[model samples]
Each structure stands twice: as C-alpha cells, then as structure tokens.
Target: MAINIMLATAMQPLGFLSAGWLADWAQPHTSGPGRGAALVLLASGVLLVVWGLAGLRYRPLRHLEDLVPDAAPPPEADADLDAVQNRVLAA
Candidate 1:
C-alpha cells in the first residue's frame, strides 16, 4: 500500500539517526566502529530478507479469524466469594 511505502521511504533518515546514536553512545570502546558497522549491516540484511519474503507472498499466511475463535465467549469468574459466605454462615 501507499502508506507502507511512504513509511518505508521515511525510515532511511531514522536508520541513519539510529546508526549515529549506536556509533556514539552504544558502541563499545574496545570493539570500536567496525563492530558497530557490522551489527548495523547484519540487522539491515535481516530486515531486507524478511521484507522480501513478505512481499513475495501474495496472500496472508493465515487469516486473523483462523488463528482465533470469534464467537466463543470468555470463561466466567468463579463463585468462590459465595462459597466463602455460605461457609461462614454455617460455622
């Protein structure tokens, strides 16, 4: 969709900002810039692979309703308080 494309396009600057923050604040002194760069590269590669797989799939893997039942009501609470009151009266 257009919205997804727009958001993906806007992510470039955010990614740059995150990379800069990682380089400045999060990166370790001993491991240095190379390690920081490697992490960023690995993360980007993973994102690309996931995005490609999702894009290639024409239909949803499964519908939301297929995963969860819509009509079944939630379980009711117990009558423990009533039982406690009855026990107190009998005692």
Candidate 2:
C-alpha cells in the first residue's frame, strides 16, 4: 500500500508532463512527420486514465468497506438498525 502510494505520487506528475508535452506537440501552426501523433497520444492517455479509474472505482480507498460489514459509523449503524426494525414491524 505504501509503495503503491509512493509510486502513484511520483507517476502523477509524469502524467501532467506527458499532457503538457502532447499539447505542445499538437499546438496549432506546427507540422511534422506525425502531425497528429500527439492527438493520438491524448486520446490514448484519456482512455487509459478512464480505464484505470474504472478498474479501481470501488477500491480507491482500499479499505475493509469494500469487503466487509461495519462500514457505517456507530451512530449511523444504530439509526440503520432502528429503520430496519421499523420496516419489519410495519411490514
């Protein structure tokens, strides 16, 4: 977990740098062999980021909440129990 956090912190800046580079590469009035390669990179990066976020959508916190009960706070748990009891009685 610690290593993953550290690596992410380091790599986070690289993503920004890559975006900056791509923006510069594809800036208006610039022409070269791969005229739109930067745009391709931009699309690819966006896709990869979206994919990564989707993959970790439920585990960003990497906590027991994702895999266990007792996720609610104590006060909330009491309220939830009361609500359930009321529903059961009403039904």
Q: Pick the candidate with the highest TM-score.
A: 1
Off by over 4 Å in 2: 29-45, 48-50, 53-91
| Prediction 2 TM-score vs. true | 0.33
Which residue pairs show backbone clashes in model 2? none
* Best-fitting candidate, scored by lDDT: 2
| lDDT agreement with native, every candidate | 0.70, 0.72
Instruction: Output the TM-score of candidate 1.
Output: 0.44
lDDT of 1 by residue, 1-91 (tens): 5997999899989888888676555357437557766776777799999987886673544354475666754333354777767877999
